[model samples]
Target: MTEQRSSPTTSGTTASTGDDGGARTGVAALVLLAACTALAQGLARYSFGPLLLPMREDVIRSYAIGGLLATVHMAGYLVGAVAGVRASARVAPLWLIRTGMAGSVAGLAVLSFSTGSAMVGAGLFLTGMGGALVWLAAPAVAVQVYPCDPGRAIAIIASSMGIGITLGSVVPALVPAVGGWRAVWGIEAVSVLVVLCVSLLLLGSRPQVSARAEESGGWRPDRRWIWTVVAFAAFSFGIGTGMTFFVAALRDGAGWTVRRAGATYSMIGVAMIAGGVIAERLSRSLGRMPVLVAQFVLAAASMFMVATGMGPVVSVAAVIIGTTMSGTAAVVSADLHDRYSPQQMAAAFGLMLIPLGIGQMLGPTAGGWAVDLAGDPFTAFMLCGAVMGAGLLPLVIHGCRRTRRAQTPLITGR
Candidate 1:
């Protein structure tokens, strides 16, 4: 059998820099990719989750419609994901990053200027599409630029999602001062545009990968990849609900004001940043699957706490949930990076997103229906918990099987 085990330390580059110099350059590259991630994925895609309630009350005017908007947004994500996979093979990765950033600004501009539902849908769809491209390109570039330490580099970039969400959630606090939510979008657009320009200047041309690395980890229809997809999908379903409706849950379920929920959401963002910072370290120390298992279990527990109406615990749970999810994503991204070369990353990662996109697309709608059926967000929260908890078992079993198989030959003296 081929070596199914993933090693984060392997790389395609031949660098001879001093440790300190390499560390410095890696950090700098990480920051650049993180900024790009924050702008493209965070500001562009995640902002919608926190902004959903306000948009519903002020503009959307219905729960079903709001859910529909989220579904549509994710639909666009699916489309963009497919496009990114194909485009990355033919285009410069930096160009795709630049395009994603520019598209986000354009989408936000549309959302800022329009009040119609069609416009909202169109804008959000565009944002989703752009976010997909950003998500695809940023890490691809990061791993390439800092191939010496792909896990840590990818973790730094992935952490930007939390930062972006935190920043977006805070916008409601400025609603009164900025005149309206639309103004917030306008400001974010300007800020992201600036980030986009910076990314273009900093990202430079795409680095060429050695053809050997490109063709090394050929796709194996193994149980491991299948479990990864299943785990990722389940996690996506659980987190997508919280991400899209956590504020609504707080407002409707916990009876907190939207402002209060938004503040709490910011806390989750902080946790996400912390998670990003710690993900690679923890994965390196403890192994990727263990870290992922711990995070997923913790996320389920956190959601359960929220479901039980433990108010004080909700914020704490939010922190753990955010940390685990982001950490899990970081570890998984790094694992994929180890599995595929820069030339093949876009397609591999994009293919992985198929299940994730489907799960995300279904989450909001499913959560909404659960709320409607149970007449409370509590049931939806519980559903999230159950799905996540169930998802962890398969991963644990499969990972153990892989580990045992990897060790069997040595134990048998083969």
Candidate 2:
């Protein structure tokens, strides 16, 4: 049985009865979703890069242990994705996201007082789990509510990560007076609470969707989708590994001061904002697959530039890498929208993220070891570039096969 949902005011459309009201609601929802994402992912996940060095100097001991904490965080995200997929039937996505935001606040609080690696890791894990729920629900709601222009909606929400990343780094870099990673967590927790309040006010009501199974068939991904999943995993591995260590790369490899490194890292946020907009426009004009392929190549090139450790080159590469990373969602979501039904998208997207989570989990570990081996971040940067470039091979094969199939149909007709 297929489920159907209708809002009393909006019915059959994302907007309400009045044109102005509908526009207001959509704008409000997008803005709120973006803020929520900034809090959930930007602060919760990406903040670690800026905070890690401080924690290491003050309390933590080993780089491997710190990286392992990030790995555990991704593990938590993996679990949360699986849980969200199962629970989506019973729970409203809006409520779930609110709950997740609350969890993030609590996790940050735990981090503020953590005395050991184990506690720190646990806090990060909690934060990641909460972030997964918020991240999943935010885009799902945006796409669900704004079906007419889902790509744009997704782009806006995804761009918030950059906003968050920028803030996460800038705040601490600017406020050395506060001192220590603990203050960063505490301040972020407060900020997240504020966003949560605004999000609750803006998105209090849930879209009415009848919870019904469309098919008895279990979720089974085909071969092409499997490759797509692998591609995403590989791409994410590079992003996860590189971004996780970006500040460290600048400080350790390039002989940059902590403040300078943090300041430079904010450029990523600027790039991300620009990239999301550019990706949306490019995907519409150039096609999603082409954009995806080009992004991977560009990301690889940027990572290679970062490996040079020249201040100017690394700074420029940071923007390019950030742009490429943030644009990933634009192509993936656009392509998936073409392939999957609205109902299936939520579940399918959730499932695909499992591999991404796995890649995220391993990325930090491998990158940290590489850094250790080289006694600098050069090897880690190159590893990210190599992995990102390697992802292109599978995508190219998929594209070639698709082209051949299209030609075969025309040949048969002829």
Candidate 3:
């Protein structure tokens, strides 16, 4: 792939590294974009996991239905991701970011007043769509601002989602004080809107980060890329199942308080904040495939611990799972950057997300079925671990064969 370098420019004004004022403005714009990512993805989308129990009590009663709601959200995300691939080719990154944030704000507002399952699903769907658009465009904008270190910029953008997750964990604690779940959504809507406005002010003009795939002969998937997608899908399945039901399992099966579960869940977000950086460094020394394989193995072990529901062990497990989840995505994204030109990056990455999204969509509902059948979440969690392990078998075997080939001695004919 040809390397594409972007010179930072906003509203057609060039901002070179030597210009101190312009550099500062670019940095500020990048920071605000990261904030938008946090609100759009972390608060609007993932806050659902922490608030699921209350939602169950208030509107959704069945575990199956609860899981279906998550599936509905993922469906919207899948659609958005696919659409983003095309949209990125035409729209400015800043406009896409702003539009996405607006959608999230609307979704959160709708959720605050929703009293039935249909309304709740609608809100979640909109939130999921908004989150996808922001995530799709944010990294490209970051790369434009920090052209010297695209990897670092992307990692920072990825990590910001963890910050949002960590903050959202505090919502469960304030559930009673502020009213119920509806009030929580209302507060988040207002907060996200405030951030969106600030982001608009900071990002005065569109960053000239063009993603015209037509110039690069668009993205085409190969056999190796398919294997990577499969691996990612499996990882998503395990993570989606584990995260979606984690708090509920602790409360219902393990008999823990909501406060305690929420506290423990916060560890996942805390670890996730450093996950991308850690994975990037490790991949530099160990190679991405080996690092990814180890991550899958560790994730399986952690999910098993989560199944046990022991307090301390589960907390440790949460950290492990969180790190692996974010680390895997970071490693995969870096690999994509290495293989595809900037023009093709958006389309390639967006297409790749489809399988992972499908896996996530299926995970929660399958876990819910397992829970309903077993009359507890233990079997569901165990099944998730098994699914994660099983899904990566092809990739593992391919890696092993490649390693063996490398170690073999070459025979010379004289």
Candidate 4:
């Protein structure tokens, strides 16, 4: 499940090389890829969570319906990922990344033009598909350029997603003073387009992608890699569940105001930042599995704290959990780099996002149900905690097997 970078073609055919110049060029291109991810993920992908309440109120969707909308958005993302995974040969992944970002930009632009439920849903689908494509393509670039240090390269690229999520939250708070919720999409569209154009100009001299892919073997992840992707999907799903509705749950469960409760979400974002930096360093030192298991465990604990009710202790616990869970993007991306062929990079990562969609679909619904039935958040928090804990089991078991195997002796010398 590994592919080498493209070999240097004969004079002027494709201009491939393993020279320092080529590596540097490819790394520069990856910087653009990371920039693209920062733009798409921040504005198009993650902004959904912050918009949930305002959009739901405006469109008159039930809590369950809100869950469905998120599910549908992720469904489109799943399709995009599968599409990336099915490549016949190495095409220029950058082009696909650009096209995806463009589609999301267009979709966001259109989202501002209507309030009809159907239009809104369609816009979200395009947005999801676009972001999925960017995420799929960008990391492939990261791995190719720094094939010798793929994990470090991928961690740098993956960290952009965390940055994006944090920025996405900031957008919502600005929505009111700026214009309206719809205007937020318009602003992001313009910002993304400008960044894309600027990146193309400054980063134009990079080596052609075809050169890189040929070296990396080709554009196909093995069938075996799908299982790992599914596992990551589970990991992402549980994390999303805890995070997606945390602020809303707090406000509802404890009768806190939006301003008062939003801090918890912000703290989660800060934790994500801290966790991301640490995860990258840790993954490099210790490898992916150990780091990933630790993160899942952190997520489980954070969910318990979040569910327990709002107190300083719970808040700290939420920070610990949120940071740990949300920061999985880097470690998982690196894991994909390790477990699959480079060509299959985007598709594999995209496939893992499925469980994330499922978990998010459940979070609000379950959280709402708990609030209703328990008559206090105490019961609901317990339920949320349980869901997160359930999510952690598969991974911990998987980790245990790997650990035991690592400890087991190899056959004696002949």
Q: State which candidate has the highest TM-score.
A: 3
Tell me the TM-score of each prediction against the true structure.
Answer: 0.89, 0.92, 0.92, 0.80
TM-score (C-alpha, index-matched) for candidate 3:
0.92
Write the residue-wise lDDT of candidate 4 on 1-414 in tens digits: 133333223212243345888776767766677778877754576676676667767873654455456556666676666665444134566666777778788878877775767777777778777777777777666665555566666766666665666667676577787888788878888877887787668655544355243433444544334434544555555555445565556666767666556655666655655666578678767766677767766666666776667578667875676456445777777666555555444455655655555555455455545555556644545666566566556656666776677567653322
Can you tell me which runs of candidate 3 are displaced by over 4 Å? 1-15, 211-218, 405-414
Estimate the overall C-alpha local distance difference test score of candidate 2: 0.77
Tell me the whole-model lDDT of each prediction, alpha carbons only.
0.76, 0.77, 0.80, 0.63
RMSD of 4: 4.5
Q: For candidate 1, lDDT tens digit of each residue in 303-343?
A: 88887656688888889877976788798776665555554
Judged by TM-score relative to the true structure, which candidate is superior, 1 or 4?
1
Q: Say which candidate scores most in lDDT.
A: 3
Candidate 3 residue lDDT tens string, 1-414: 243443334224344556777678667777888799888987788888899998888999988888888888888778778777777767767777888898899989989999999999999888888888898888767777766667777777777787888888888877899999999999999999999888877676645665443623656886557877887788788888887888889999999999999998888888878887788678767787888888888888888999898998998998997787667767776667766666566566777778888988898889988899889977778988898888888889888887777667543322
Q: Candidate 1 regions off by >4 Å?
A: 1-27, 205-217, 344-346, 403-414
| Tens-digit lDDT track of model 2 for 1-414 | 122432222322334525766667777777888888888887677888888788888766666777788898888888777777777766667877888898898889888888988888888888888888887777767776565577888888777788888888776563476776788788888889888988777677736344555411355677767777877888888888877788877777888898888877888887887787688779877777778878878888888888887878878988887787678776676666566655566667777778888888888899888888778777877998888778778877998898788799789997
- Worst 10-residue lDDT window for candidate 2 reads 1-10
Look at candidate 3 and give me any clashing residue pairs.
none
Q: How many backbone clashes does candidate 2 have?
A: 0
